[model samples]
Target: MITGIEHIAVLAKDSKALTDWYVKLFGFEIVYDNGKGTYFVKAADGSMLEIIACSGDCRPTEPKEWGIRHFALSVTEDGFDEMVEKLKVEKVEVVTDVAVSPKGIKTFFFRDIEGNIFHLIFRPTPL
Candidate 1:
């Protein structure tokens, strides 16, 4: 039977830099560094992200890309606001500013160093 997701793989032009970016932004720690362009980072909640080294530059994801549009990392409501502010202070590209839905879910989106769009979501109730 299929279980939870093991990891989400992303291609990075510079694997080491991308790995460091996650470590700096989020609290993700390096679990494995294959020395070749592949690295594994483990998030605080035990989620894993596999970064694969690639040669070409990464382009921002398009909504019609026929694949995953974006992936989100959950954060507390307070953390959500703090993250949005931090992103703004750091001059990072903010795709969508913080907004609260009618259902009370707060979310914001931004781009990473590799041009990957990531969302920070906060749900009043746990999923």
Candidate 2:
């Protein structure tokens, strides 16, 4: 049987900065800092996102591009609104305004320090 997703790895020009950005924005804690361009960040639900430092130009995916578009981080309804406000105050680039899908999933997208797009979603009710 297939197990759940363990983690998602992303290559970054500056792993430390990317790790710090997740920690600051989403409360992810640094579980491992190899000091050699590798960082393991753990979220509250035990999901991990690995940030690997690399030497190359950072190219983030954009809308209509192939490959992965973006990954979502589920949040509470209240949290969703609060986060949007916080991002605005922080001057973080908001790629899209808050919108609700046909399925009633509310979400908004934003860019990280490295221009990686992340969707903040709130599912008020079960699908």
Candidate 3:
């Protein structure tokens, strides 16, 4: 029934700000924005992360939810430091600073303006 992750939806209080943040931080371009509370962001790989505003009863999920804890993005080993520097320039909050895992991958965690945590990681080089 499931093939791969099509998109992840996030509830946004300020859709424009969220859209702009992704654009500025990771170079995500806006594929579509309805102006009524729904917007779609796409990366170079065609994966998308959507944001929709809630009104009366709609609510965003907490991190402890049973499904979809958070999203992870892979970066190149050489690009790891450059990526962190870019995030710093944008003034985004980095919850977990860069660190190397036992498996030899370099990783870091950061949150969007809306508090959605995302991980950026790079694979280790061959010995």
Candidate 4:
């Protein structure tokens, strides 16, 4: 049986910029970095996001990948606003405006510097 998400890995062209963006926007801290192609990030809930540099002919998904289309982060209301503001300050493109679900959760979508979409979702209470 599937337990849970192990980690979401992104092939980074500039891993340093990606790492810095995550740290500044989402409070992700570096758990490991070897000054090489690999780095690990630790979220507040202990989830991990790994960044690995890819070379030669490699490219990000082109809207036709088989699975794991995108990644989302659940944040508090305050965190959601804070992240949005930070992105705006940094001139990162916001692809989707904030929207509320029928279940009353708020979510907004944005892309990383490399065009990787990530969602910041606000869940007011337990599901």
Candidate 5:
């Protein structure tokens, strides 16, 4: 039987700094650190993110490259405003302005410290 997603992988030019960024911004717990740039960070709900280091030889892929487009993280309805302000203060690159779907789901798109795109969502109803 298939279980929930174990984790999603993301490449980073600076793995350590990206790991620190996740910890500082989302309070993600470090699951593993090789002390040589690779790290696994887990969110509050056990969702894990694998942060892999890319060296000088790494070729950057376009945003719409054949794999996963972006990772979406959910924010509580009450914290949605606070999170938006936080992103503004951090000077994060906004990929798209906040918008509401027909289902009334509010969402914002932004890029992470390592230039990976992410979606910030506020769902009125839990899935």
Candidate 6:
């Protein structure tokens, strides 16, 4: 049977830069690096992301690309505001201000170093 997501993947023109960015900002540790421009970084909670460099002369994805638009990470309700402020202090580019969903979830959008979007969310109840 199907389970939850194992990992999310993104293409990078510079694997080392992207990997280091995740490690420095999100505290994700490098699980594996192929030494040929492919890396797997794992979060403290066990979630993983594959950061790979595409072959020859590839470019970063545009913000308005037609694929998966953004990835999300959740924070505890108590720590939500703190995390938001932390991102601001780190100078992450904010795409959207906090918005409340009908489900009472609050989320804000920001961009990673490579312009990939991320959502920081806080929910009143876990689904």
| Residue-level lDDT tens digits of model 2 in 1-127 | 8789988888887888889989998899999988798999998999999999867677888967998887788888878889888878877788998999887789889887887888899997865
- Cα shift from native, residue 32, model 5 (Å): 0.9
Give candidate 5 misplaced runs (Cα > 4 Å): 56-63
**Model 6 Cα lDDT, one tens digit per residue, 69-104:** 899987778877887888898899999978888988
Q: Give all TM-scores, in the order shown.
A: 0.91, 0.91, 0.81, 0.85, 0.90, 0.85
Question: Which digits, one per residue and each the tens of the lDDT, describe model 1 over residues 39-115?
Answer: 99999889999999886656667755877888899998778877788777767788888889998999888888888
Q: Which scores higher on TM-score, 1 or 4?
A: 1
Candidate 3 vs candidate 6, lDDT winner: 6
All candidates: CA RMSD in angstroms? 1.5, 1.5, 3.2, 2.1, 1.6, 2.0
Off by over 4 Å in 4: 62-66
User: Which lDDT value does model 6 have at 3?
Assistant: 75
Cα misplacement distance, residue 32 of candidate 2 (Å): 1.3
TM-score of 4: 0.85
lDDT of each: 0.86, 0.86, 0.80, 0.81, 0.87, 0.85
Q: What's the CA error at residue 67 for candidate 4, in Å?
A: 3.9
Question: Lowest-lDDT window of 10 residues in candidate 6?
Answer: 54-63
Clashing pairs in 3: none
* Candidate 2 Cα deviation (angstroms), residue 71: 1.2
* Deviation of model 3 at 97, angstroms: 1.1
Scored by TM-score, the top model is: 1
Using TM-score as the yardstick, the better of models 4 and 5 is: 5
Off by over 4 Å in 6: 56-65
Q: Which portions of model 1 miss their true places by more than 4 Å? A: none
